[model samples]
Target chain A: MLTYFVTETNWLNFISSLVSQYRVFGLIDYEGELKWRRLNEANSHSITITKYRSIQPIKKFFFPVKEEVTAEPSAQKTILIGCKNCDLNHLKTTDSMFVGSPVSDPYYLKRRENTIIISSDCDDFRKTCFCTSMDEDPFPSKGFDINLSPTRGGFIVEIATKTAEQLISVRKHYFQDPQPILLQEREKMRKRITELVKNNNSELNWTDPQRIVSSTYNSKAWDDDIASTCVECDACRFVCGTCYCFILSETKDIWSRIRTWDSCQSAGYARVAGGGNPKNTRAKRLKNFYACKLVYRKENFGFYACTGCGRCIEVCQGKIDIRQSLAKLKKLEKNV
Target chain B: MFKSPYKSIKAELLEVIEETSNIKTFVLKPEEKFSFVTGQFVELSIPGVGEAPFTPSSSPFKTDKIDVTIMKAGYVTEALHNLKGGETLGIRGPYGRGYPVEELNKKDVLIVGGGVGMAPLRSFLLTLLEQKEKFGRIILCYGSRTPEDVVYKYLFPEWKKVKGLEIMQSVDKCPVGEWDETVGLVTCLLDKVKVDLAKTVSVVCGPPIMMKFSTTKLLDVGFKPQNIYLSMEANMSCGLGKCGHCQLGHHFICKDGPVFTYEQIKNIPEPFA
Candidate 1:
């Protein structure tokens, strides 16, 4: 519960000073949208804390899209800033996948141990946002080294872990006693974010994701509603926060085998060498995505694989909205 | 080359019989002792090649040796076909839940198998023959694409010597000179056997299509789904449950089952679908 203040005007200087002492990364403007980029002391002035989540998950930093898992590990000390609650939650899911078994993945472990994370509050919401339905707030309440709450005139920062305490000591000039007025301003921001999420509930209604999964087992709604325009490009899986399907490929015939992400949406994902695919139809494949996220992952891993990050909505080429697909599945349940 | 659930035992290949153009049977004996329950499978590996799961065709009571029958269907099996006698290879496991022997107590057993599907069931047949006095009548129905594909061809006379056991074999066609049994599908043999459905246990294994048709025929004869068991074969990279490749929904074929009763997973979508 350690609190401090950084004025809105000097927030850039505060971030710049921290960047000089630590390897820092933060959300920055990429083209027109926000994405994570390396932060240097000179460019910290341009970093934004308002975007709820980036287009790519923080996983790109932890587990790269394609990494040499078999190579000798080399991970640099780094800090990731501006991570949202949903992004942090997805990282926890990846943690177990990397660390759960005796054959722990050294590639993920090397980066995880050496990196520190600083999460900022979600001060705004997008039309596609629905973290509330997934029971996650846009803001991170815990599981962060440092928590930032944006206020009208300044930022209310709370140090969470010992790593954050070390960070605060190096930037002691930015600290000020937490004033009641600034605290009130941050509370109002939190309230507005919650209200925006609540108001957006109708757009995300899917009539209980569990029933949609069970009833759509052999439903024709998949072909009729979703499959016609699928194109099978695998964009949905790429943008998903919890899709962990990978194919371990032999690389360059020399360096060790590497696991690359594969999508159930792809035509070849489930095929064996002898050319037998249990899931062959587009309808069958689309149904698998829902089943994996809502039923199979919960039954096996005890966690809903989807964090409602809404990245899929932004990336789909067919204009397929995941929220609408679930809603349609819910409506088709009665006919089944 | 890769870690598997069972440790490698130094074993020599006693014989390799070309059962068919695409399948062969290797009879192996470990330099040391290795014992397993009937109906359990072992992981066989060839150095510099991959590993695959194969059930021992020989009865488990014969501890000094193991006989594995393999079909050259995929990567590892192709490597297994090239190995000669006295070559060193890895072996692990006798894993997965085997046949429920207790449930077969005093009950007539119907063993249905197709082509190389007889490999695992052969272990059960040999064990049942040894303990001939414990069970009711034993009936074996085996079918293959041709007479040449019918495995364990030399053991017919020995099995016939058992008083209460019946072995009915069929080939798709006799191929001119080999005409000693019925023709057409193996399900046609069900007409000749009499069974009390409530007091019978049936084990069927084969290619997915054969198993599907055999199971439907068995159910038509009033066999309970719980009493009908089937073996599932997926490309298993790791014999342990660590790898997700062998998964059928939430169940891993390597660990949860290579053998599962129809009642346990009748409703799981996709592979069972």
Candidate 2:
């Protein structure tokens, strides 16, 4: 790993240089909401390095909402920037689902292989943010090609992978040895952001989420509370970084096979012909969705599926907060 | 880089056998040699239409051709039924765990299949018959909706002639025809057959309700959960298990099993539900 201090002006210039070589995507303000957009020479100045997190997760870069698995791989290289820690953690779950074992998804693997990831620290927290409750930090500790921590007038950059190291070596003059005082300031900023997240999510009860969720399989809170408010719009699943369940359909003419994002909340997700559906009711489907995040995925993939990005909370039309639901599940566990 | 699992191998439809009013068995010859053990399934794709999982009904030993019996119940199958011989389609696997025939060598076997569920069981039966001398008595109790819905009707007479094999069939109702066989649920046939409960391994595949009721009856007849196998089906998109549509609890029906012993999946939240 190589650490350097790059001035804001030089950092923007490096980004501009990379934009000419790779398709650079970063966070920018769109209608007051931070969303991912391609960073070009014209808009490189407006790119934010300290946004909480992008509204759209980094999943779309590697696993698009829809793609043809049999199609040719893209030739252009891609660089994703300004990714938060929560989205980076989600890469772990998606990796296991798409890249592991007896069979792997070639489409996702191709995109992942052709892309470089650049993550940044979160300087602030949203009202819906709850990564700390799920035992994840707001800033990434690992699993990125490059990491940027906002400093006074520049970025404390850490090159974690050989790909990033090679990319920076081409424009080596822009990077300088970090001063010890600036490094200390960067560490303080990281800690302050972590504390802010913990304090913001303090009201939510935290426990062994896996144990609580497994024991509360029959909890009335699912039907009596969560189910009542859930509109089944599937917005949360669509926005989630780790919800990789997909449906394979053909075009109307039947010439091409298409793989598109699917949601468990949908009525037909688990339904088979002759109408045998395990998760038939909306309440059961909602319960299964949470169980997938808390229990089922952990048992299968060795980790909780939820990265606690809070995107689901923001997009949910029913105002049904997953943090609140997990808290309620904990209370129900105690009652039982 | 490994080849994409989603890529389907081409197979030419050799012949179509109409098993029932709405069900047809399409015999296909893969462009490449495809081999699978009895009780395994393959994803059949109609180029532009879509793909769905169907276990080959043909004997695994007959590598030249494969049989897939489909019911005209869904959109994909509806498209499949409209296809003719000499047309090309795609096939992906021999996915999921097949029946454990090697373990059942010296044990008596009881197979119960209902409706189109008989397709996979047919493969199991034909394979078991190839080495009939190695196993004890094989009893198959099949049921369907009506006389017109009975599949493999042409093969029953020949199957009865096998040394120690017994075939018993029942229909839920007898239409306006000369129906001489049993006219009750498949579970009723279990009472008429005699077997040493300690030595029998039961395999069942059917509609959800039939499987549930038949499993209860099998239990009532003293069949151990470990000795019972089920060919479970769900909406499978990617036969390699990348797609999560076929997931049941922590198990991927496309990977962990399309065939699981009752004891293996009994504790999972909703195996039968």
User: In terms of TM-score, which candidate is strongest?
Assistant: 2
lDDT of 2 by residue, A1-336 (tens): 789999999999889999888999988987658989888999988888776987798999988888877665563599988999999999998899898666778788888988899999999888889888888889898999999999988999999999999999989999999998998998899899989988998897676788887788877778888777888899999899998999887665444577899999999999877666899888899988888888888998788889788999999889988898878888788776
What TM-score, over all chains together, does every model reach?
0.80, 0.95
List ranges where model 1 is wrong by over 4 Å. Answer: A1-24, A39-45, A67-78, A92-115, A158-177, A180-184, A198-201, A251-256, B1-17, B26-68, B74-110, B122-139, B155-166, B175-179, B189-201, B237-245
Which residue pairs show collisions in model 2? A254-B48
Model 1 chain A TM-score equals: 0.92
lDDT (tens digit, per residue) of candidate 1 on A84-132: 8888878766775565443456666778888888888887766677778
lDDT of 2 by residue, B1-273 (tens): 545577788899999899898999999999999999988889899987778889999899999999999999788898888877889988988888899999997999999999999999999999999898889989999999898898988888888887789989999998656577898999999888889988899999988788888888988888999999999888877877777899888888888888998888887776788
- Deviation from native of the Cα of residue B22 in model 1, angstroms: 0.8
Which residue window of length 10 is worst by lDDT in model 2 chain B?
B1-10
Off by over 4 Å in 2: A252-255, A334-336, B1-3, B175-181
